[model samples]
Target: MTATTPTPTPTPTSPSAPHHQPLLRPMDLAGLRLPNRVVMAPLTRARAARDGLVPTPMHADYYGRRASAGLIITEATWVSRQAIGFADVPGIYSAEQVTAWRRVTDTVHALGGRIVMQLWHTGAASHPDHLGGRVPAGPSPVNPRTRSFTTTGFQETVTPRAMTPAEIAATVADYRAAAHNARQAGFDGVEIAALGTFLIAQFLNPRLNHRTDAYGGDRTRRRRLLLEIVDAVAEPWDGRCVGVRLGPYLAAGDLFRPDAATLADHDELVTALNDHPVAYLHLRGPDRPTPDARPDTAALARYRHRFHGPLNANNGFDRETANAAIEAGTADAVSFATHFIANPDLVTRFALSRDLATGDPTTYYGGGARGYVDHPVSTWQDNPGQQP
Candidate 1:
């Protein structure tokens, strides 16, 4: 990553320039038309109001500034109180929350941007503090041994109480309600957060789930919870407006490892998703690739070969590599996270081949306006009067 430095504003150029041509090209995701192939990945800023877990004006301004991307996936949002684990993250369960998010969607739409909400549930990755002194619920009683972002900051996770069949049914209903709320809030679509060690991912991992009931044990049973949620969430807006995110290469210490069996499980999961009518399958690629690794062995390519739907690749993709991935037919589009933080005009910067600004790590999460909306956009030197 390059350090942020002051540079003279360069002249503005056409976004359809030859550089990174594949990334600048227009794309149609489901029925949604995107101006470019660069999608903004969902990033957790934890900047919502602490009182009701509602999005504030700061969130609206923050997302409104980066509306140039083809699609913006808002930060992971809690679907219900039981889905909460982190402090200050927004939720979509309340009427007040829906109103607050409507402001955000309106701002982005006013600027000609397409946006979606990422539905999330932390499951065992939660602290008792966040759950009102009660242990969080998960598929089993196993502790992930991971940390949770509570009001008191990061705390060691405790073994979660196993959810009953009735509890599972209620949780599925929660997802359906959240999707309805998102639509009411004026979002173009919703993406299910099944990545990492979240609730859905926990159910998918054989090591973390030890239940002998219908929701656990072999691959077929383990995937029941996720499939059920998918079906439930699609009830509101249909599968064409929904996207599913999967992270097969995400490893967290000894609890969740990207071993052969884990990869095989995800391979099966991706193949099974074809049975559903999801708009797209978002796959998180490897964070760090070995120098000897071939493009065919990459997570994006591996899953692209399995899933027949449109594929959106994420994680550690730069302009050149993102274009290459699309050029090789391994990915239909690429989603960027870190880059969008410092460069609100990331699409324009990539179009003109300008140097990108690096984000300040200290202000990445839970902050005021400085690092959130103060990042400068590239200006046109030819038009000295133009402002960024």
Candidate 2:
């Protein structure tokens, strides 16, 4: 007379392959040992307290549930008040925020999990309302021609004030301070958010950066700000525990179209990172398939050849394909975003070949524990033999 939930049919794996997948292999990430190659990528679920921008017990429980991942990259956290753009996003600039994050880290470590904080600055992606009635700062005074998530709702982005030389240096110092605070918060490392045409990427892309100074104009100059920020962050944690995310292929369709020039600049960016040598190069490509319906394998190969360190490849990778990439030596680790959202036991599901629960898109952001931590673990009743 006990009530029960129906179990979905188990998916089949290759007959010749072992029940254990290549994705389950233990690997090294910037000298830190990982139990598996599966990484939980940073996803922005705005559940933090709005006033102080601090994490709570809910955040601790959310991350603790997914402790089985080899590594967990936390959502983008503002390095300073100037970096905030969206409401309810977390920050690490103050002592209160750092202390709050420590609880989350302590919870994860209690379960023997590794985690890293992703430092972020939204730049032109922010609106004045979110910045205490001050225009956002960026590499150039250009509008991203996009909308941003604000307190009221989605609002159009305004033209951010171009950063002066002094302001640029201040921003780098902010990154340094954030790195120091991250260490205090007990994070395993820090990842710089340099993708999606955000603060750092704004300087990388020519379309967004139209400055006529050392921080812009050409490829080398455009990369100056990002490299400087890297140097600042490395001072606190060293290069071994640092990683940078790059999405050169990402651009505004209506405002800025990508051309051969953009591709060449991205190549230069990879080469520069190779010379500096961070923990890993987080390379992202088109989120979905192209017109040909094929993942950009050529782009992935090109990036792998350029970056000498461990390469963390992201963007819509499934269990089968991700395993294939690892087996083929194309990627050292694979980070899951959406999959991790719905299934806290994503690594187990992949290893056991169990059906994954569907994630609720409606409650993806600005919500409580409904879709954040309420997803049930797979019952796996039909395939009891496939337990990991």
Cα RMSD for candidates in order: 5.8, 4.9
Off by over 4 Å in 1: 1-16, 289-297, 381-388
Count of backbone clashes, every candidate in sequence: 0, 0
Instruction: For candidate 1, write residues 37-150 as lDDT tens digits.
Output: 999999999898999999999988999999999999999999999999988899999999999999999999999999999999999998899989999999999998899988
Q: lDDT per prediction?
A: 0.88, 0.85
Give the TM-score of each candidate. 0.92, 0.93
* Model 1 residue pairs with clashes: none
* Candidate with the greatest TM-score versus the true structure: 2
TM-score of 2: 0.93
Q: Once all C-alphas are superposed, what RMSD does model 2 give against the true structure?
A: 4.9
Worst 10 residues of 2 by lDDT: 9-18
**Cα lDDT over the full model 1:** 0.88
